[model samples]
Target: MIEFEFVKPSTVADAVKALAADGAQALSGGQTLTPTMKQRLATPSVLVSLNGIAEMKGVTVGGGVVTIGGATTHATVAKEASAYPALARLAGGIGDPAVRNRGTIGGSIANNDPAACYPAGALASGAVIVTNKRSITADDFFKGMFATVLDEGEIITSVSFPVPLKAAYVKFDQPASRFALTGVFVAQYAGGVRVAVTGASNNGVFRWKEAEAALSANFSASAIAGLKVSPKDMISDLHGTAEYRAHLVKVLTGRAVSAA
Candidate 1:
């Protein structure tokens, strides 16, 4: 690992200021960052630890929206299943207990891994990413593989998601890593329906417009009957072929709609 300085800020303002310094990177749960550092992929001059900021941790649901603090761990969400069952299910499905205890929503979304489940949930729920500067819609927050709209020194404070009338997530996990080979999140909101697919595409997270159209017409599993996703756009890895992952997208989407 590369040698680096560490700064633990007591507030978001302090963290942001510390991050504005040269070669600074925010450390939330360190689930992805730590590994990247260990592999010599990220060699920051300073690590701004957000754990010291009390404002960046917790979950709040009210007025038809759910706001999750940046530092809120998956274990907290899983343990408080009664608040949001679907969210609890999503959190519980993240990884083993150790990972769930440390990995955070902010870290996951900021990293925006192609196979991460939180992105799917955010997209499907029409979540807004609240950063130190401005709020970014999920559609604009995620750019591509391991890319996002976050600017240099910008910090994600929290994420606010509109509560869907009904929603559910389904994923086909790789047995060894528990990473989603293909996962789908289906949601029926007031304006319309949204279906976000993760793990199957090179684009990281994308909306299944065809499936959303079908579900909007009729919110039912059978509604996805004629929806066919082209494998041309999906990612092909050792876990599954592009065609296989595409098939799973439709299948899991149907299951999610049914479960919702």
Candidate 2:
């Protein structure tokens, strides 16, 4: 790991200020950040640890919504989000015990890993990303693989996800890293149904509009019959081919809807 200064701030304001300094980067659970740093892929001059800020960790629910602190660990979400069993399941299955204990929801989404589970749940559940500057809708927050709309030095304070009538997340894990090769999250809300596909797309996590429309009309696994995901926009690698991922998307979507 590259030599770097570490700063632990007691408040969000202090952390934000520290991050504004030259070559500064934010650190939550250090799951992704730590590994990248050790690989010398990320070498910030200073590391601002958000774990010292008590305000950035916890979970709360109100008005049919689940509000989670940005620094809240995956284990916390798995234990707290009992109201949304599927979400809790997703959190519980993120990584092994170590990764789940250290990885934060903010860290996962902010890093915007294409195979991450939180983004699927956040997007499918119609969550809002609360930042120091402003609230960004899930649709606008995730830009692409390992990317987001977060501005320089901006701190994500929390995320608020609306309670869905029914929801389920299904993932095809790659075994080693346990990252999804292709995953699907299905949700039914008062407004309509939502289908968010992750891990398969080359661009990033995205809504399956065709499946959404079909499922919204008939809320069931069989409703997505004949619906197909194009392989042209999917990722092709050793773990899985574009055609394989596309097939998994449809299969996972059906399973998720059935489970939901």
Candidate 3:
């Protein structure tokens, strides 16, 4: 990796200010960014670490919402976020012990990796992404693969998830990385049901509106048993074909509903 100035800021404001400098990049868990840096793909002049910020490192639940600090590690979420059992379970399944101990929910959300597990959960839960400047809904936060609406100097401070009446996440693992080959999160609320799919699409994490409508009417595995996502939008690679991923999406969504 290239030489870079590293600063561990104790507050979100300080971290945001530090990231305002030219060529400065905000560093969260470093699970994703560090690898990119080592590969010489990203050469930031300065690294602003968010781990030291005490205010951004805890989990809280109240008034039908579960709020998790941006700097909170996966291990912390897995251990503490009991109010949202499905989300906690999702956190616990990310990568391995070392990665779970180091990877932050905010980092995972910010990176918006196509195969990452958290995005599907967030989208299905209708999460609100809180930043130093403002709050954004999960639907508005994500743009596309490896893309988001986050501004240059803005930093996500926390994420607020509306607790669903019933929810579950089911992922078909990629084996080596443990990243989702095709993951589905199903959440049923008082209003309706939400279904989010990840790791299968070229456009990144997205909602399955057809399945959502079907499940909203009848919340069961059989509700969407006949539903199918077109293979055209799926990501095709050596691991699996677009058709295979498309099939997994339906299968996993059914499994998630059953699990829920």
Pairs clashing within candidate 3: none
lDDT of 1: 0.90
Clashing pairs in 1: none
Question: Could you estimate the TM-score for every candidate?
Answer: 0.98, 0.99, 0.99
Cα error, candidate 3, residue 27 (Å): 0.6
What TM-score does candidate 2 reach?
A: 0.99
By summed lDDT, which 10 consecutive residues of candidate 2 come out lowest?
220-229
Tens digits of per-residue lDDT, candidate 3, 149-208, equal 999978889999999999999999999989999999999999999999999999999999
TM-score of 1: 0.98
lDDT tens readout by residue for model 2, 68-152: 9999999999999887788889999998988999999998889889999999999898899999889999999999888899998
Q: Clashes per prediction?
A: 0, 0, 0
RMSD of each: 1.0, 0.7, 0.5
- lDDT tens digits by residue: candidate 1, 1-260: 99999999999999999998889999999988999999999999999998888898888888877788999899987775445567778989998899999999999999999999999999998899999999999999999889999998888899988878888999999889898999999989877899999999998999998888888989999998887889997999777999999899989998998888
lDDT of 1 at 174: 88
